[model samples]
Target: MPCCRLLWRPQRPNEDFRMNKQDLSEDTEVVLLLCGRFGGEKQEPHQPLSPREYSELAKWLNACNLRPSDLMTDAGRDALSSLQVARLESKRVEFLLGRGTAMALALERWARGGLWVISRGDMDYPKRLKRQLKHAAPPLLYGAGDKTLLEKGGLAIIGSRDASESALSYTRSIAARCAHEGLAVVSGGARGVDAAAMQGATEAGGYCIGVLANDLLKTSVNRQNRIGLQEGCLVLVSPFFPEAGFSAGNAMGRNRYIYTLADQALVIDSALRSGGTWEGAVENLKNGWVPLYVRTPGEGPGNVALVADGGLPFTLTADSTDSLVDLFASRPVDDVQSGSDIVETQQLLLVPEAMVTAEAVTAEIPSEPVQEKSQPLVSPEALASSPAPQPATATEVLAPSEAHASGDAVGTVEEPAMAEQPAQLLSCLSLDMYADFSAKLASLLGGGALSEEDIATQLCIEKSQAKAWLKRASEAGLVDKLKKPVRYALGRQGSLC
Candidate 1:
């Protein structure tokens, strides 16, 4: 069953991540030069800057109202010469930017091989990356096939590369069920559980997303995947290069992408205290990327421990699970499960990099596993690509002080007088963020309705907050409130204008 491959550098693909210019937008080209490895040189003199380094540079750019693309221009070059950014030398920036030849060669090769790349700043970039992971989002992503499949959120089925046969069967069944329900089944595209899951879904003629840790070039052209790729039913993406090899660090880093990309994550199996599965699940819990579910009858110690750590325990039997949509049905955020309850939820919003504080990039994350991370959570403007439109009349927001009474709808609690509320609780939200947030939220619902749980999960906000946002969106006529299951769908567009 061709399980997930282990850490081994392939001798071929001949040349990997040799980037290029021309086809790429200036922004992406600049990003690649600054952060990408141009696939040559045993010991290159000017190593690319890291994400944290790029972030620090971004802050300076935003401060000066300059973009990365601007750096290539004479005016931007003058600003670089005249301005002093801490810890960054003008020469260092120049050296990185000088790799135009390497960039062009790499891109040309990658493109010829049917690979494409997108920068975080691109509107086509997955909104989930911007909203869920925020600045932790990768600067560049390389992939093969349709990029739109990346946004069609579905369950992220993750497990050990060495999962047992029974667990593999379960993963396959679940993936197939998701396919039958018209939901995309996302996985690491590794061997073992990952392989089984994708196989099941694609075999069932269902769409799937393969978020690979490495080996995209090989995977894209692999005989087993060629049919799916050709059918436009599969998308394989990587934060690393298309021709990059497997590294344990890359494996670990890739897990966050899987979790963030999905509506929810389900662990079919996991190793205890180690492996990419364990580390990724631990990180997801700390970050609350989404409500995770561990297989109920799994043998692995990691599965047990994860449930104890607050993962929802779920059981999916193939025949009984015809529809995956029910799995994401609405649930209250505050009325969370007591022990092991199933939850059906997912959603996310985009944040512009300029709003993130410079210090956040400098803060070190803990080395060991921790239940909760200290990083500030991305506020739940869920799904805004740009600022939401301000209506002629003022619309209310779900402030911290406003609490839900009960159920999914905004509970009938009387609003507290503005005078009585704590100053901090009523603090103003960035109007641009809110506007962008609403427009994005509208876009998300434009397809189908979503529950409070779905909104909360995607936006990375509390469920109560999702309920509040829905109520406000409903009032503004941006979204229509549906009863019975209590979901919100796109409202009249003309009404907003």
Candidate 2:
């Protein structure tokens, strides 16, 4: 209702006022001014505007053609009289004037600390949060360091602040592996697992996105973190004020930001009953925002329950860097098994013709009516001679075999020809005719770089469809063709868009 209260600290008499009003956008300056005015004071209750309140305010501003600064003007007062939220009369005007008067000093303080802010309307706000949280996303983000890192999705490593040394070590190793794979490491910027993961990623010359709940101004310039920040490998951001102290509610709420910003999440250790780590993991699983992984044989009961309740188990080895990359980069499967659990060696079996009895063949047939052998789907010679079929129409939806059958006629052929001779025919098939495969193709391309083969394997689409999607993506400037063999990476414009 009051848009939250501000607690102003007295500036030293000799403190330099280096920041000017021009340093920030008119909108941002006004928001900060409002925050400075109404935000919590020392020993006073600190009640920041709730997401719903922010949404309401945004709607009012839009409807009334009022910028935040307009609220302090004569016209603003007239407009405020018409808005329900600002109808409190004298008190509202008084508060607005108070904050407006302090705007200069507030800007100076923020500038002195090298602090910056992005409102929800800003283009630089993390797209992931905008997509995942939508209306509930933070209205403002105060941050420091490389803002571009926010655009790079990565693995989120989260756990208790007092995690076991082994758990922390596991997190660091996984983070390092993620770095080796060219992924950023996302964390809550807390102690133990979060800190270990961030440190590991930066130490490996990889990027890290730290979503801090409080004390962002203090933490961003920490001696240990300064190098990474300066190197553009670390970005620390928070939804709270730069000087806001730790609040349990803020910490728990910030977990969603960490999870939503990441491509996937790993839980090292969580208490079974409660705690920020446990609650966050549970909320993430419930929302299905990302694929949640819990360390197997984890240090706490929470791990066992999480796995039982659909959390995937992440088991890593010293040499599993490639496997780890694939795990996070690939889309999640219904089953919770990791790639490392899959055996790669192929097994060959020798089945004698005699082993396939007539009864066995008959049993394999579906109970549904089958086309008679007399009317073969496609005689071998006919398939070879016929031109490739045109894309199917909606009413003519047919399986590959059926489509082939309807196209041409020829004499029946031997079984071996039927099994091995149609490679050329299948290659000519147009996968665009299938809508489901087309959608999957688009999804895979947006996720990351993929060779045609990778798309086929990952999306379970046909090779031809994968190739077609890659070509389409290239044409649309959504992907770039790379090197020999033609792998595709998301195009610069594509990532920015």
Candidate 3:
């Protein structure tokens, strides 16, 4: 019934024609309806496609360079008659003509907030995803968490949902190390290893996210270490509706998303011919995306085969931070080394008039007690009548530029210093040209519009460092972060007055 809704958007214009076709055969009527019917029910239930419906679909598939096998059995055609063929072509036209009915449902969620769509061409879509799509590309993606994380390279760690104790320990270690190196770890949100990796990032004070196979809301039932998610330490996502339950097919489909979400995939441990995770690895290898196989003392020969076939070794104890740092440092330095426009912009951002007004409100005004009449000889009664002066806290409303300047002077310059850095150095940074990026930063902060590429270019900092800066700014009553390539913006609260 709901699937019918998916097909109805474009068919409204032909409703009269459909209504007039009372004499149409059952097979022709079904084909004209363009509904996917199960193969088993076709003959046994006396349901069949007209020869024409069958032939036209075959032609369409051939034209698309696909076989009839490309579509699901439910979508296949049984042979159709001559008249049915003409009707089938019209039905095919209707199927292809459908409007936004299916899309509208997905879009409604996004419009209501907490939903995002990542199509194939979006720059924020992970490049790794593009690599995997070459083999088994998804139609569309709906997810949560920092979208920019997709752009900032990270390592994917995955393993059995029913992992053993030793496997989990090793998985946790690798995940924590990756987080410490400022790399986000990606995994399917099953049990065991996935949970371990997410918790590891939380413990390490780093960001991590889970890609789920089931409807995110249903599978999140036993999400034990949810402290991380609640605290914005980790991201959780699923392609299905939040209420959808688990299915074997969906679980296998999840492997693609996990691999697609990362720059490299690290298989901690897996059995031969395990679901698509292994298949996904082979697919990834074919696509030239690197696969990292961890070497365990008891790992089977299959892992060795993987290693032999161009899969790289993921040495957990190696200089992970150095490797990640180098990766980040290798990013283009032009954003920082460019021209004078940035310099002027940085200076303007330092002390805009708005910031001055906010600061003035916080600055204390000295009180001048009314000049007492010449009754200085008055006793304790006069002293008791005097009002006591209340102590005021020192307040400062420095812009990002000012914060950088002061920060540089103190030699405690960390990423995104509020008002402390050399003007020249500050000029190199890029900022969003919002009417006000700091408006609601105090209440609903942490979502920014910066992509990983945008951040890489603007901050002229390593990916991890940019994330750290965003995290700090988010914590400090500054910005708001939205899921999916987590962009930052000002919070709903006014400011840190």
Best by TM-score: 1
Report the C-alpha lDDT of model 2 over 334-416, residue by residue, as the tens digit.
Answer: 45533223111000011122332222110101121121111111122322323431111000000011111224234331122
Over 4 Å off, model 3: 1-113, 121-124, 131-136, 219-232, 239-243, 273-277, 296-301, 315-497
Provide the overall lDDT of each model, using Cα atoms, as 2-decimal numbers.
0.61, 0.57, 0.42
Model 2: CA > 4 A from native: 1-22, 36-48, 65-75, 86-90, 333-497
Q: Better model by TM-score, 1 or 2?
A: 1
lDDT value for model 2:
0.57
Q: Give candidate 2's total backbone clashes.
A: 8
Kindly list the per-residue Cα lDDT of model 1 for residues 1-497, writing each as its tens digit. 11001111121144353322224556877888888876984477767887777878888898999988888777788898865766678888887887766766666667665778889888778999889988789999888777889899888987754554555666777877888888898887765567767766776678888887666776666554655676899888889877666555676677888988888888876554445676678788878878888775454534545665667766656557335686666533222454213112111011233442222111111132211111101111211233431111000000111111324345432222222211111111134445445645645654567787887788777787778777765663345666677776654211000
lDDT of 2 at 76: 71
Task: State the lDDT at 389 in candidate 3.
Answer: 13
Q: Would you list the rank order by lDDT, best first?
A: 1, 2, 3
lDDT of 3 by residue, 1-497 (tens): 12334344343444343221222232222332232222233233223343334456556655555433223233432222122434454344344323225333433333233435444334555666656554244423455445565555577776544454555566666666777778887766544556656545555677775676544432233233234444555565655444344455555556667766776677655433233344555555555554444342213212323443444444443223446445434543222223243233333323332433321111111121122111111112311322431111100100011111112233321233232212211111223421122322211222324554465465455777666666755563344455554565443211111
Error of 3 at 111 (Å): 7.7
